[model samples]
Target chain A: MSKNLHTSAPDTDTAIDRNVPEFPVAQDSDEQNYFKTNQPPSYLDQLHKSTKEFIQFHKDQGKGRKVVLVTSGGTTVPLENNTVRFIDNFSAGTRGATSAEYFLENGYAVIFLHREFSLLPYSRHYSHTTNCFLDYMTEINGELRIDPKYSETMHKVYKKYNDARDQNLLLLLPFTTVNQYLFSLREISKLLNLVGGRALFYLAAAVSDFFLPHSKLPEHKIQAQDHNGGKLVVNLDPVPKFLRRLVDSWAPGSLITSFKLETDKSILIKKSNQALDRYNHQLVIGNLLQTRKKEVVFVTKDPKIEPEWFRLSDEEVEKGVDIESLIIPAVIKVHEDWIKNHE
Target chain B: MSKNLHTSAPDTDTAIDRNVPEFPVAQDSDEQNYFKTNQPPSYLDQLHKSTKEFIQFHKDQGKGRKVVLVTSGGTTVPLENNTVRFIDNFSAGTRGATSAEYFLENGYAVIFLHREFSLLPYSRHYSHTTNCFLDYMTEINGELRIDPKYSETMHKVYKKYNDARDQNLLLLLPFTTVNQYLFSLREISKLLNLVGGRALFYLAAAVSDFFLPHSKLPEHKIQAQDHNGGKLVVNLDPVPKFLRRLVDSWAPGSLITSFKLETDKSILIKKSNQALDRYNHQLVIGNLLQTRKKEVVFVTKDPKIEPEWFRLSDEEVEKGVDIESLIIPAVIKVHEDWIKNHE
Candidate 1:
């Protein structure tokens, strides 16, 4: 068994060895050689490349341009079953969306995170645009017939939608629950990290405070059963205050604006002040919804400048209210003053 | 012919003389009736009928009940053109509707004067209902859904649309702008006068402050023109404060409740108190809508018991925490306490 030449032979010195020699591998290769030698790039790689290119292009254009992030509408909350609930409000997105466009018209990139039934047109021509889609499953009406001059607006929106569909951007995370809204806010906060200091976040979303605390996502579609004759007694949990958290966690230098809609003049002013104090926000826009005219009182922490309230007549408050003329100038002025004083 | 027929003519002459007086008297039979034979019923008739019915119904049911009138939603203003202008809000009729139902549940007859887009279900089951029709058109999915429940709610609304061939309520009065809202409110006030003091009025309509200062109803239908690509700048005039007018015009001892929603707590209380002072209202429901849960503070002009604030949790709030609970109970308690103390 050890020495038969015809069968197998250990040639004189061949033995079981502990140490074995291995050949050196190449770390780098030319493009042509690599293509020939390796597998094709994955879909993820192409997506990453495209996203990087888009980001780089935007970054280049965004230089010297202020950026605004406007959150609009009411968040929906999902129930135990597949059925969803919403913290519905009568916000036509008139104030926020209009303000956003005003900001964009004044040379700012707007990232609009809007909820369903928004009356403001998310035009693409406003330079840079991005939407945090939340109501994809919810059906929307046909495209609105807008002025043809707003072609750029249309193009930008189409591009954003296409990119979202292609997974070039993060697909909108749908939330119908308060907890989900909180989660979405947290996720948005993480995304804010990439925005750096050039970001101006306007939190105008009417987030609900109470949601089904014990709701559980169904593993499968549950059969429609009228539980207690469709009279549901939902036990609601207190939602975590995101605005309070945003002010607490974010850097103090960040410019944040909060809105307060009130009926009483004095109460609205006081609330605006409290908002400034609680959030450390640069400005608080307070308005009374009961009145026809969109009169807003801007409150800031600045001591030397008395808090000024600007009243926009109904005509002035119409769709074309120039944000630059009315409120933004004050905001910019305050910013300039703050910089001057701090420096 | 004269002599022989004279005898027969004498009878004819006598008959003719009876018809025509010697002094050329006027025809008594043909005389225009200065006094109306069938006069329409008056407030006295209504009072008699109501009293009889009230006594009979109480005798049959063996119970005494209070009556409440709740007015919810926005009113419209009439323009110079056939089209009307609306001053509306995003109220879903949740608060006012729920409070009306609460009154009903508490064995009180409710007169619900609701505007368009109200969530209150229209049924004959209600003790007495009156729907105040405002000339506002709401377009949903490109199709108009006119407020059809108008007839079930009010008699005046029935008279407005009853003659029209088109059953569509939108066609009855075309609301083009905010001016129409003022006109509508004026008409509603006239109707309110008919309701009398046995009713409690709740002013929950979010009325607009400014109206189209100059709007003319076109002799013919104004062809829809895209004015400067639909960028029309409308001039607005200030609308008269209806709540104040309502407070002044309402019958004495009528329990009136006004609402004020604010973002600041201290301001809300102060404003609510001021509302009490200005309007001399029995109670003011002050709510803060910053959070999802509607925590409302009720303020009354109770000299003995100090103003108290109650915080409802999310669940309780969502369960439709109504001002009626506080209102009805407090009203009953105050009346009872007054009786006991006076006795």
Candidate 2:
């Protein structure tokens, strides 16, 4: 029924489907073996305890507010167990953090699982930039206060932060390594399943598709002296397609939305549609790495539906309007429809 | 006449000198060639302007206040030009930033060249932690204020921040990739050299020892699909030892101190002494990754002098006394003697 698997593209490189496994082609069962082989992260017990508490607290409130679990930033794949060096994906967590604020604004409690020290929803206004935290404050009359130039924005961010905390709408969990990310993702998805249709998964994290399994990594730092004539060879196993399991088993009732980031202009829509078909997820938000902040395309699975584009106007960009504000409302509408139709 | 090269250690593995070139050995001149092969970073012009301005500003002040250029945090080595993935060294920039604060406290105008988003001197009180920045703040009667529990320490950090900025004692220059770091380091070193013996270099940044040359890297993201049966081979040239150049040519009169981090306890001293001999720099601060904050060894080249240990006592550790407080005073004493001997 899917017609565009290898449709003619505007570019010659369309023949290479980079995401699909071809060499020693991996099957779905390999993903199960991956979890069986690798040890679960040490933080799993702590995360489970926190997740259970968060879910129960929301249930006790009985506000019937939707819960969105937003994953942000990039997961690192360590080259060694002692981890002197590791490969990191390039992401600042701006999309995820900004979207979290919008989600919180529109009656959703957020579970923000992000890379440590990347960015937080309300704190995104000041933290994780080149600007020193002290730059935001001024000494006025022998007392420290927010600088007058930034007082207006600072006040807005501060109040929202307090409100979110007081209302118990924001819960933060952090992850660093790829192994920790996978373990936490599975645990969190299952935990959120307790809410059934009310749970939404926004998978914005740039996870590494390939990683050296913990078993293969050296116990100490990798020595540069051993490289064969300056050539360093690293073996990485494809991180199994956990998305299928995520849709089928874990959090099956939640509305799942994942992102597709591409550098090429020609294959963006085609690849996004392919992911939608493969995972059978509700939506794939497609973005280019360069223009991600200004524009994104919404690719849904229904054959008759055309892809939707949500873009920021130049004036909106000039006015400091986040594109996530527009994206979240559209996602909410889709979530509302999914809940109704599933019932 | 260095006597302690590979002094018998507690372990048999002590024979392996990890830093020694075993593969295709790279020479000192190859570093200069490597810089020419790679395109200079886009921000080079901007950084040069800032460095020039900062130096001129320091010169404009007649106090002849000793200037310290403290390099902090880890430098990343990108695997590709578009840079979807990079290998990162392990550092949170605590040592460099803490040392900078003590330097400023002891009357040195400081230039902080740090990894972007890593800790800053006075602002280290609040930023780059798992806790949200908002956690340190509270609102009462619609007025934003530092949380009362943290206000005492926050007040101290805040006042020092105001003092540093007001007196123009701090200049911050941030870098991300190794290429940018090398470029900036050279430029800043040269600029600091304009003041001759008055400058001090505290090199604490965890710089990468290996990197794929820019000419060898792919223009786009490195595709995982083409891995030879899950094995990814990456060829990395040894990062040229620029320390020798720094000691011999760039800022030769400055008192230079570098760091050596080792996981193996036995090799720590041997390696530290090797660096001091090879670079012929003034000092090498040796630390183990695990107990870096609690203790360090100060290695000097004077054959009669034994390696000095500056350690934190249990009581001092319990009291949250930073070992840098001790380390800085010792370094200052060394700096004072160096200045005196030169005069």
Candidate 3:
């Protein structure tokens, strides 16, 4: 349990733990109740048909290459049915968007399930930064052209984005609420299973841990004065552990990689290890909130194997090297190994 | 009190109500205590310096032209000091940003106090729409240029945005939490007082009605199982009514227009009139949640005067006529009349 990064394990030859912990039977009914009680996303029919087409197109285009389902952004938990207010997680989805680009570059088709208005794979390169989108444009002689300072980078990003669209390597789906996110995830997991173990699930979205059934919420906006002494109180139930169902029943024999984000760095690796043990997943990428943009530690199943840290050098960071460029490659390596082992 | 739009009243000659309701002295100490307890934003010094400079620059640029402080987007109620989760209002800043542009077009310098990363006045013409920002760009012979389909509109937007920046007619200041927004509003209201009766306050931001003092929230993320029956319960106090303070002392004699949004249409006009009566502000722009983008009602003092509706016809909407185009001009007319009457 050495917490130091890049430490070599003395017992590298220790066999990996193959035991699957018994599924949390107590929560299975709770999860089932969640799905039975909640309504599905509005555009689910279209999402399903389009996703099938995307997977089939790539399958016909190439036989043995991998496919990744990348979930990004933060899902909302609405406080009321009419939804004047909601609890939201603060995430810009930089990790998921950047990782999708790397996955596409690595020749894997990507299904990007993201929060509706959060960042996207290529468009994120321009918008939502310090400069406004209009800053890139200029009117010269009645023609609208990008400023010279940005044209080169814009061209490269646009070229890759265009390729992804034209070659059928990417599919974009948007979800707003945690309810929609969970339901879509369950359905998409079944669709991704068509590819067998060759599929990789990159669960990066900041899914809420707490939620309320639709019946529990007020029919209209909460009145501030009607509550206790002009105060508001919210009672929320825990969203069932859907990851267990995701790993156990929905996408059987698939490679699932989840992210563990912690504010305290002291317990980051330990919790990541626990997640792997509990869910029996392939990998857990552990990151601290403070240094997540620059570094991450990979936590695998074997207790004897010291967790490997991936980091961007200060020089590389200054040069604008994205850490996702490294994490994606590491993930693909294990994913490919899993595919080969399953075969 | 007919709810129908554009209904005219026979009592047109009735004198506008000059009676000011006695101020709620009870909440004055409550507001002061709240301000004393909450921390100001991190960038207070920079924001203060820039805002002062912006007001002075606009003053020297013109003698009698009115200046507007436009607050846009929605504020957050952070659940924790570190802020992993929070309550958020669902606002895209469409109403605020769109109105700011019209304000500028009417020859007024605008200080846009907005939520960080929300839509902006000129840049909003292209970004945050259904299409991605990259969709507007085309790679032509290794040059990044505007796509032909969007060039005309892009050029128009770029020209206006460029003009605003070059003339110092727009100053952008950003805030995230309700704490920062309230603090900034109080500070900016003081500075705006320098312009005397010429300053107009357009309070359009969807500030949170409920908030919690930092001392009340847990220091870390709320763990699910640690709570009763795996549920989370949050208690939040109502944000103090700052509009009363804004009218009586902060910017005395200024023309203040505040927006009142309601989901229940039956109560919309009644609440708007009550707000005007309670705050003694010049105008209350009342809007329904469903039809706000297309229509609004102007609620002034003298309940005898019927509310006047501003709307966009179907043909006008089809031709892309922004409702703000109509609303802003009407607002300007009332503002101008208010200035003349005060003189």
Candidate 4:
């Protein structure tokens, strides 16, 4: 048996961070160097302008224009620069999209940062994975009309969507790779931070924890040709936990809420605690992979506070009710308290 | 560099194939053994039943019914059992989806085996990535109707979709993992095989060329904990080319058309020709990654035939015409010739 191995030398990555001074977040060595080394997304400037416009729109509406940055969907980690293939996390952005709608209903302007082609706020009612959009409309009297079966729910959704658009309360932005997501997160955090306690960071996106640096990535698509029974080996560096920077510097004075997803039951609360302790973020929502849609546990930064559980009943599940309906209002209360404390 | 190398020995896969008789594609050893080593998709039986019913529907209708299996979108290769991360190919199934619409229009029954949430035939008009459905609709006197801007085109698409449903001319089935796709392809191929030359195999799906065998995958999500600044390594085995088995056994008398996508212009035709030589399939369509939407070259199995270029003009591009509208007709013509020659 012949063996062919594809690998990268890790000695280069570990050698130390000697020259990291260009960006802020200087205390975190790896994350600070990440920006210096990697190229920002192509549309970073446009994204910044749009974000500023969203905040300014709220400011013009007079006092108490609370804005929430809703980061949704999963980020991909490309193995090659040309990217015929990439490592993707299992997420459809249901949590963030659902929460964004609820936030809007509660009169909070939303900045929806999402993965391309994942579910969105109003459109989630008629998702792409389910029945085709055409199925919901029937031709009658030379005009297409909404099917009576779906008209009631869709009409309500359509009205809400119109109100959102008319009020300019929703800003939709897309990111594909982990780098794009990270860079945009920084820009958004900085923009929202200026709004101070009026801003809230609802970080629900399923960010990849590992990524392959540009230096190691192949220029073209990885060839699948067998080299005497070959194996394609991919070495990925740990994606620096930028939540630290978000809590400490990026979005200071804002209520930062993040998620902790675990497959193991015993380690769920423990891991959530570690994140809260490490970043001292306002809240860490802990949920297991299998039951995330129905249940979640909130672990707060206050050491004396106990974890709180939130769940939906079987009847709610049968009725196709989203658990986010409960989750967002509770977070709003916490955010309200946060603003009061800071004031 | 303190390298924490994660690897698997290749001696395990390199040994001579044993116990491959159970599968019919035993003429090719690796593909036959692939089925033995891997578990069939959980829904394989249901998929088989559904596919058979589609074919039987055409048979029960009348004579001279031509059926085409249109496989679309990209298949994912899971890196772990719990599958927090997966290797995904970049495809939205535009070609296959667009071509299926054309096929149904040309009086052919289509079995659309597509990736979950990918673009569909009529639904491609309202893709999830493009615009929210609510954006395409309007309320007039408390009644929601298709927006006038999109009304004309959408009405046409809607009528065509209703025709498809009334006639039962289209069957839509979805696959996620590459294994599920492969298993379903084999079953669909055999079902279509009995129709002989009247059946056409349009293999447009972007299947992964490499996969991780279950023997090596981790049970849970790959942890991002830095082991002294650790690098995560993944080894993938080359996926065995199943075209050989598909042509020779699975769909013996069907017209097999496949696609070759390349980023490098220099190697495109040469590699495509190599595949033609290896598989002896009826046709291979070669296109570069950037130009796939506009231009493609048809490489036939016959050496005497020159490579044919089929491209849309700049005017056509400006008018928003799909290249598949042209490609599918040409393919249908080729299939017609194939059927006549066999007769």
lDDT by residue (tens digit), candidate 3, B1-343: 2223223332212111111112222277888898899888888878888988988887777787688999999999988655678889878899999999999999999999999889999998777777878887776676777888888877888889989898889999999999999999998998888887789999999988778786676555432221125545566666878998899999997899999887778878877887787777889999877788899999999668799999999998899788899889999998898888887
Give the per-residue lDDT of model 3 (tens digit) for A143-214.
777877888888899999999988888899999899999989988899988888988999999988778787
Local distance difference test, each candidate: 0.43, 0.81, 0.81, 0.82
lDDT of 2 by residue, B1-343 (tens): 2333323332213211233342233366677797789778788888889887877788778356788899999999887677777878888899999999999999988999999888889888788766778787777677777778877787789888889988988988888888888989988899888777788899999998777777677666544343234534444556778888888888898999998887878878877887887778999999988889999999999989999999999999999999999999998889888877776
Among these predictions, the greatest DockQ belongs to: 2
- Model 4 scores a C-alpha lDDT of 0.82
Question: Which residue pairs overlap in candidate 3's backbone?
Answer: none
Measured with DockQ on alpha carbons, how good is candidate 2? Answer: 0.34
User: DockQ of all candidates, in order?
Assistant: 0.01, 0.34, 0.26, 0.30
Report, for all candidates in order, the number of backbone clashes.
Answer: 36, 0, 0, 0
- Positional deviation of residue A340's Cα in model 2 after best superposition, in angstroms: 0.2
Q: What interface RMSD does candidate 2 have?
A: 7.0
True-contact fraction in model 1 equals: 0.00
Better TM-score candidate (2, 3): 2
TM-score of chain B of 4: 0.90
Report how far residue A233 has shifted in candidate 4, in Å: 1.1
The per-prediction CA RMSD against the true structure, in angstroms, equals 33.2, 4.3, 8.7, 7.3
Q: Estimate the TM-score for candidate 3.
A: 0.91
